[model samples]
Target: MRSVYMDHSATTPVKPEVVEAMLPYFTEIYGNASSVHAFGREARKGVMSARNTIAEYIGASVDELFFTAGGTESDNWAIRGVAHANKQKGNHIITTTIEHHAVLHVCEMLEKEGFEVTYLKTDADGLISLKDLEAAIQPSTILISIMAVNNEIGTIQPIEEIGQIAKKHGVLFHTDAVQALGKIELDVNKQNIDLMSFSAHKLYGPKGIGALYVRKGTRIKNLMDGGAQEKKRRPGTENVPGIIGFGKAVELAAEGFEENNARLIRLRDKMIAGIEATIPYIRLNGHRTKRHPGNVNFCFEFIEGESLLLSLDLVGIAASSGSACTSGSLDPSHVLMAIGLTHEIAHGSLRLSLGEFTTDEDVDYVIEQLKPIVERLRSYSPLYEKATGGTR
Candidate 1:
């Protein structure tokens, strides 16, 4: 049996070109970016070039980009840094309930530190209303951190409109664009986004590397202390090879983004349509139209998600579920719950995120495999028996 990967939102395979671009840095130019020596100069050049490429992709200046470990670190830095630096102006921050743990956990930490955090609720479509955002703003609000695209549901938030609201209220706007960087075009200036977070791994680049876009003149305190690396914003020896790979990946993504998006959208829509048409009692999650092209989340009623996941895995199909077990307690995804999914519905949710490498055959394979797995799970479900009038 051939394996099919439908979990790009978790991480994607490193692109071949990106890997090639990083090869030279590891062996030929393995020097500390902080050193003034020739080897260091080569490494520094690679880092700067990568920064420039990333900046161009997001329509930000090279000086605005600061590399970090990944989206989590960047998110932590952006939220905490801004809160610390802007405390004189305000002590309150705003964010939605459906954000990734990176943002949500940071807000929770801030709450423990005497800062006020307002987690706005989203509608059934996993979108935070601009009206609700406007109503949530307080005089002491310092920042609003919303994601550009939801990682689990692929819901695209109204970032630009939120940016406008932030600006109008004299608050800084930050967005975790980790899932949106390559999937959608980003212009920090046009969107009035004061700070943005992106991870390389989400775009087929190497892991352990990401960047935060802090608009020039945005006063954000440093999360890390030490060397003046990343302009004293983030400290540590730079990952030169990873940065190079990231730059190559960004370049390729930008070059092929239009075509790749169209293809992935077609595949995702086909899969969603096929699954709904073939499977009974399935409900789609997220915005039907205003979602990421590669995301498809659905809930199959009357069956536990873990059982369905295991059944799919048996046939060489890799997928994910929102269910939580007792000990591990992964429970239903907060994202689904935020979007108003009942506990039962959330427990049965599955997220199938496609990528540039996903093919029509892959989608078809999943569709074909999913029906039987769901049927098998439903066969043992008491709810299914009741709904279908079958004898228990």
Candidate 2:
């Protein structure tokens, strides 16, 4: 069987070019970026070059970008750092009901520490209401955190609008753009985004590397307190190899970003059309046209998502129900629930995210295999039987 990978949201395979760029750093240029010797200067040059490349790609200043372990660390630092630094100004932070666990759990922790949190609700299309956002802002509200694109349903949030709202209310705005980087056009200055988190692996770079963007004059406390690295904002020795890979990936993404998006959008639409034409009683999740170009999510009622995932794996197809971070949990997706899906419907959802490596053949293969898989799973489902009145 030909293997097909449709779980780009979970993680992406490192590209060849990225690997080639990273190889020398791991062996030839092995030196601590924090040292003062010639070897250290060489390594520091690589780090600065990578930082400039990423910063230019995202329209941020080099000093504004700080490297981290990945999206989780970036997000945790953004939320905790901003909230703590501005604690005297306010005690309230606003977010959404469907954010990634990194942001959601951080908000929960802050809540336990006496910070008030307001989780805005999304409509059936997984969109937050601008009116609700404006209404939620309080005199005590100091920060607003939202993801650029949802990991599970792949809904694109109105970051620009949210940013404007935060500005109007004098609150800092942060966005988790791990899923949006490279797939969409993002300029922090144009969007008024004060803070943004990103992961290298999501954009064909190596894992264990990420970055956080902080606009100039933004007040933020350092989560990692140590060396003078990252302008004294984040400490610890930088991952020279991984940062090189990320820079290479960003360079590749910038070369033909629009062209790649057009190709992926066509493939995604083809897969959605094929699956919708063949499958019955399935509800498409996320906004039809407002979602990411490579995202396709669906809820096949009366089946379990894990079962469907395993069945697909057996046939050499890899997909996901939500974020890789939340896999193995028996509970239904919080994102699905936030969009008003019942537990039964949410449990049967599937997410297929494409990437640069995804081919038309891969899309066709998944559609051809999925029809039978859904039928097989639904046949074993008592809920299906009861819903269909034994119609089969």
Candidate 3:
């Protein structure tokens, strides 16, 4: 069986150049970035260079960017930090119903602490209403947290417009850009994005490394306590090799950003068109165009998503039903529910995300295999029989 990976949203394979850049950091340049020795100085140089590269890529200042374990930690620190620091000022927060668990779960925690949270709804396309966002804001709403892109449906949120609304209402805006970095354009200043979260592994960099962009003068403080590392905002010994890998990945992404997007979009559309033309009773999730370039999602009526995933895997094609973080759950995707999908329809969904390594042949293989898989699965479904009026 020929292997094909179509789950880039879950994670990506580290590129060869990124690995090469990280190796030296693991061996020769092994020193705590906080140490005062010469070895530490060498390590510090590398760490600073990595910081500069990432900071530059997002148009943020080096001082404003802080390293975290990954996207989860970044989201937690941003939401909790801002909410805690501004407690005296307000106890209300505004976020969408379709946020990742990192953001939604934090909001839930804050709610238990007596904070009021407003979860804005999304349309069938998984897009939050900007007017609704503005209207949801109260004088006591201190923060507005939204993800830059929906991880499951690949819906690109209106970050700039949301930022403008947040700014107008004097509410702090934080976006989980873990899915947006390296694939889409991002500028903290231009987008008015006060705080943002990112992960390296989502963009072909090493795992366990991520960054948080905190614009200067944001009314937020440290959530964790310990050493004076990370400007005392996030304190701990840094992961040197991971930092090096993330930096190199960001550098490569910057250089080939446009060309990479063009290729992924082309291949993405090819696969999407193939699935649409060849498959039946399928509903495409998310906006047709205002989405992540490599994202392609569909819900096959009368077919279960997990069964489809398993069948695809048997043929050496890896895919996803929804966010990897919640893959093991028996519950339907909250994102799909927010977009008005019933439990049955959402359970039949499949997400086939492309990436830098995805090729034309790989996509072709999936489409060819998918038709038979769906047909075989639906043949066993009583729902299929009823829907088709016994016309199998």
Candidate 4:
């Protein structure tokens, strides 16, 4: 059986080039960035270069970007940092129900602390309305935090428009661009994004290293306290190897940005088309076109997502039911629910994400394996028997 990996959204394999770039930091030139010695200065040079590379790629100044553990920390720091720093400005914030738990949980925690949050609803396609966003903004609203792309369904939010609306209201705009940094075009200035979060692993870099882009003059407080690394904003000895790997990954991602996306889009559409044409009673999730180039999600009727995943795994095809973080839970996806799917449909969802290592043959292999698996799983379902009257 051919092994196919379709879980790029969960995480990506560190590119060989990224690994190569990181190798030097482990053995040679290893020094804590906070140290004042010559070795420290050498290591600090590498860290600064990486910071510059990532910042430049995202159209940000070097001073505005700070390294963190990963996207989750960046999100927490962005939301809480801005919330606390600007509390006197307002106590209200706005986001969506479809956000990753990183953002949702943070917002929920803030609510418990007496902060008001307006969760703007999204349409069935998972796109939030600009009108709802505009209307939800109040004089007491301090921040508008939204994801640039939905992790589960791959819905690309109207960030530029949302940013404009936030600007009009004089509200600070932040985007959890964890799933978006390398996949889409992001310009902090052009998008009017006051803050953005990113993860290197999402872009084929090392895991456990990410960055937060805080536009100059954005009122945000530090979330951590320790050594004076990361401008004392995210103080800790930097992950030198991880940081270097992240920089290389971003550089590589930018090298063939358009071409890579075009290829992934072809693979994505082909998978979607193949599954839709072959599978019965399957509903495609997310915006048909306005989604991540590599994301293809669907809700298959009758069969549970976990069953489908296991069957696919037996065929050496790796996929996901939803966000990797919540995969262990029995509850259906909150994202699918937010998009108006019923409990039955939501429970049957699958997310197959394509990426750099994915190939045409891999996609073809999945299309070939998926139909039989779905059919076999449904054959055991009483609901399927009832719906099809034993015909399936």
Clashing residue pairs in candidate 2 (N, C-alpha, C atoms within 3 angstroms): none
lDDT of 1 by residue, 238-285 (tens): 999999999999999999999999999999999999998999888899
Model 1 off-target regions past 4 Å?
Answer: 322-328
TM-score, predicted candidate 1 vs. hidden true structure? 0.97
Candidate 2 lDDT, 281-370, residue by residue in tens = 999999998899899999999889999999999999999998799898999999999999999999999999999989999999999999
For model 3, how does the per-residue alpha-carbon lDDT over 296-324 read when each residue is reduced to its tens digit?
A: 99999998999999999999999999999
**Candidate 2 global TM-score:** 0.99
Q: Which consecutive 10 residues in model 4 have the weakest lDDT in total?
A: 223-232
Error of model 1, residue 332, in angstroms: 1.0
lDDT, model 3: 0.94
Local error of candidate 2 at 42, Å?
1.0
Overall local distance difference test of candidate 1: 0.90
At residue 316, give the lDDT of candidate 4.
96
lDDT string, candidate 4, 143-214, tens digits: 999999999999999899999999998999999999998889999989999999999999999899999999
TM-score for each of the candidates: 0.97, 0.99, 0.99, 0.99
Residue 138 in model 3: lDDT: 92
Off by over 4 Å in 2: none
lDDT (Cα, 0-100) at 328 in candidate 1: 45
